[model samples]
Target: MKINTYIDHTILKATATVDDIKQLCKEAKEHHFYAVCVNGYYVALAESELMQTDIKIAAVVGFPLGATSSYIKVEEAKHCIDQGAHEIDMVLNVGLLKSGGYQKIIEEDIRAVKKAIGNNVLKVIFENCYLTTEEKKIACKLSLNAGADFIKTSTGFGTGGATLEDVQLMINEVHGSVKIKASGGIRDLNTAKQYIDLGVSRIGTSSGIQIVNPT
Candidate 1:
């Protein structure tokens, strides 16, 4: 399989700068990775840098924390799309999920963004590290119901990262209606392959080059 194409070459650190984003686009082009994932602020810059190339730009909304109001998240998604982000990786409202009985609010939140983006890809980040198995499954269902294109594993800013068990559970949970993206703590070729082998359609990592060329 073409592992490079499966990668969403990412840089979401709060300290990221213009030069850093330029370098990220540089590596993504050199590696021919599928996309360059950045925070909302850099979507336009990434779009400019990757303009002539086939590389897609994916941006994060509500970022590492999913506690933002739906209005704010929706506005952020819209702004990113306006700035040329081809896809959005949005954090699910984990607080609401854990709080329980906020299922409709959570689903509506996703739907609102989906509606705003309209046909652009939406990958719901479950941040599985903080969730129980059932909670993960519930998030998967909510994403699918809200018309998500992919179900993502983590924000990488969470206490933990992706695990095979979580990926497998998500796989079964979606039943192939939506695609899967495994992110966080995936730093090597073998690990990337393991997730790919298990049917993840995308790998979100900062170590794209290292995964392709370890030496």
Candidate 2:
């Protein structure tokens, strides 16, 4: 399989600078990645740098922590789209999910954000590291019910990254309704391919180059 098409080249570190984003876009252009995932503040910069390319710009909302109010996440999603973000990877409100409030709140929050962005792709990050098997299933169900385009495995800033078990569980739960994005600890070609084999439609990693060229 062509690995480039499955990758979402990512750079979400707080220390990332303009030069870093520039280099990111350059690498993404060279590798022909499916998209370049970045912070909201850099959406415009990344868009400008990738204007001539077919690469899509993905902006993060609620980021590593999903505790922000739903209204704030909606605003963040809207602003990112305004800045030319073609897709959004948004963090789910972990607290709400864990508090037993998920059933009522989770799907609505995702639907609201998806509606705000119009036709832009929406990938909901479950931050699976903190969830139990049952909780993960619940989150995936909520995401699908909310009409999210993809259900992501992790935020990468969480206590842990994506695992085979998590990916399997998510895929099994979501069935074939929504696509899956495996993020977090996908650092090399083997790991990347493993996720692909498990049926992940997208791989989110800062190690895109290493995975693409493991020499």
Candidate 3:
């Protein structure tokens, strides 16, 4: 399979500069990646750079930590979409999920964001490192129920990144209703390929260039 099509070529570092985002957009266009995932602040810049191309712009909300209020995340999603973001990869409220408020709080949060974005794609980040197997399953079910387009594994700024087991578990739990995105710590070709082999529909990482053209 063509690996480039599965990548959400990403650069979400706090230190990322305007030049960095420009370069990222350039690289994504040249490589024909599925999308260029960037911080919400750079959505406009990335959009300006990627205009006229088929490449998509994906903005992050709630980021590495899902501790922000749901209201804030929804606002961020709206602003990014207005700035031309085609997709949103939002972090789920891990605290709410672990506090036994999974259905009431977390699910509602995701649903609100989905409604705000309307027809745009929404990928809910679970930050899987913080959950147990059962919690992961519950989160997957909640994401699908909440109308998420994709159930993402990590934010890449978490304690750990994606794992094969988490990818498989998420895929099995969603049962094809929602897509799976494997992100974080995927630095090489073999690791990325393994996740794809397990049926992951998208791969999120800053190492997209390396994964596509490993030396």
Candidate 4:
């Protein structure tokens, strides 16, 4: 399989500079990656650099922490889309999901962002490291119900990253109604291959270079 086509070449560090985003965009174009996942601030810059290319731009909303208010996440998503981001990777409301009885609230949160983004893609990040099996399944359901285009595993800044079990669980839960993205800690070729083979539609990591060109 063509690995680059499955990669969302990412760089979401808080310390990421303008030059860093430019370089990331350059690499994405060079490698013909599916997309370059960046922070909201860099959406326009990445867009400018990636203009005329088929490569997509995915912006992270509410970042590693899903603690931001739903309103904020929606606005962030809107701004990113306006700045040329083609997709949004939004963190799920972990606290609300764990609180129980807030399923509707959580779903609405995702839906709000989905609404804001309109025809663009919306990926709801479950940050699975903080959830149980049931919670993960619930997250998948909620994302699907909320019109999310993809159910993502983790935010990569969490205590853990993607796992085969989580990806499998997501696959079984979504049942092809929605796509899956396994992010965080997926560094090497073998690991990326594992998730891809498991049926993930996307891979989010800063290690796409090493994965595609391992020395």
Candidate 5:
């Protein structure tokens, strides 16, 4: 398979600079990656650098922690969209979801972000490292019901990243209605291929170059 096509070349570090974004865009173009995932601040820069190319720009919302209010996440998503982000990878309200008392709030938060982004792609990050199996399944259902286009595994900055078992459980719960993205810890060809082979529509990682040209 053309693995590059499945990759969302990413760099969401807090310390990422303008030069870093420029280099990311350049590498993505050279490798023909599916997209370049960046922080909200760099969405426009990446867009500018990637203009005239098919490479997409994905922005993260609510970041590693999903504790912020739904309104804030929605606004952040809208701002990113206005800045030319073609896709949004938003962190789910992990605290609320884990509490198990605010299930409706979690769903509404995702729905609000999805609504703000309109037809643009929306991927909800579950940050599975902080969730239980039941919580993960619940998160998948909530994201699907909230109109998310994809269900992502982690933020890559979380306590842990995506795992095969988690991906399998996500696929089982999503049932193809909503696509899956296995981010975090996917740093090599074999790992990326494993997730793709499991039917994930996208792979989010900072190792696109390594995976494509491991030698």
Candidate 6:
């Protein structure tokens, strides 16, 4: 398996600077990662740094907290695409999903962002650590129904990261309607391989270098 191709080399730190993004793009190009995932503000910088390479730039919307209005999320996604993001990883509204009010609202949230991004890849972050097993299933269904390209396991900022059990549950739930992205705690070759073995289409992590070339 080409593990590097499965990785979305990521740096979403709140304190990330332009230099950090430049270094990120450099490493991504050197390592031949599938993409570089960064915050929206730095998509243009990453684009400029990676324009010569085939590496895609993924931008985050709604980020660690998905409490923002759907309109805001749409705007964020549009702005990121405008700034040159080839893909978007959007946070699902944990509050709304937990509230159990109307599931359509959550679906609409994904749809709005997907619409804004057009053909760009859209991965919806479930932050599975905070959800129950049933909630996870519901989230998978909503994301698929809303046209998400991938269903992500976590935000890496959540209390817990991707787990084998969660990935399995998601795989069973989505049933290939959409691809899966296992993020968060994937920091080693073995762990990353484990998720890929479990059928994740992508691995989102800050440890791409470590996973591909461990000490």
Q: lDDT (CA) for every model shown?
A: 0.95, 0.94, 0.93, 0.94, 0.94, 0.95
Question: What is residue 138's positional error in candidate 6, in angstroms?
Answer: 0.5
Please identify model 3 stretches exceeding 4 Å from their true place: none
For residues 44-80, could you state the per-residue lDDT of candidate 4 as single tens digits?
9999999999999999998888889989999999999
Clashing pairs counted in every model: 0, 0, 0, 0, 0, 0
Whole-model lDDT, candidate 3?
A: 0.93
Candidate 1 — what's its lDDT? 0.95
- Candidate 5 off by > 4 Å: none
Tens-place lDDT digits, model 2, residues 1-215: 99999999999999999999999999999999999999999999999999988999999999888888889999999999999999999999998888885586878999999999988899999999899888899999889989999999999998999999999998889788999999999999999999999899999999999999998
Model 1 residue 69 lDDT score? 93
Checking candidate 1 for backbone clashes, the offending pairs are none
Q: Model 2: what TM-score?
A: 0.98
Tell me the TM-score of each prediction against the true structure.
Answer: 0.99, 0.98, 0.98, 0.98, 0.99, 0.99
Candidate 4 clash pair list: none
Candidate 3, 1-215: lDDT as tens digits: 99999999999998999999999999999899999999999999999999999999999999878889889999999999999999999999988888885577888999999999999999999989999998999999889999999999999887999999999899889889999999999989999999999999999989989999999
**Which is better, 1 or 4, measured by lDDT?**
1
Q: What tens digits encode model 6's per-residue C-alpha lDDT throughout 89-195? A: 99999989998976999999999999988999999999999999989999999999999999999999989999999999999998889999999989999999999
Worst 10 contiguous positions by lDDT, candidate 1: 129-138
For model 4, what is the C-alpha lDDT against the true structure? 0.94
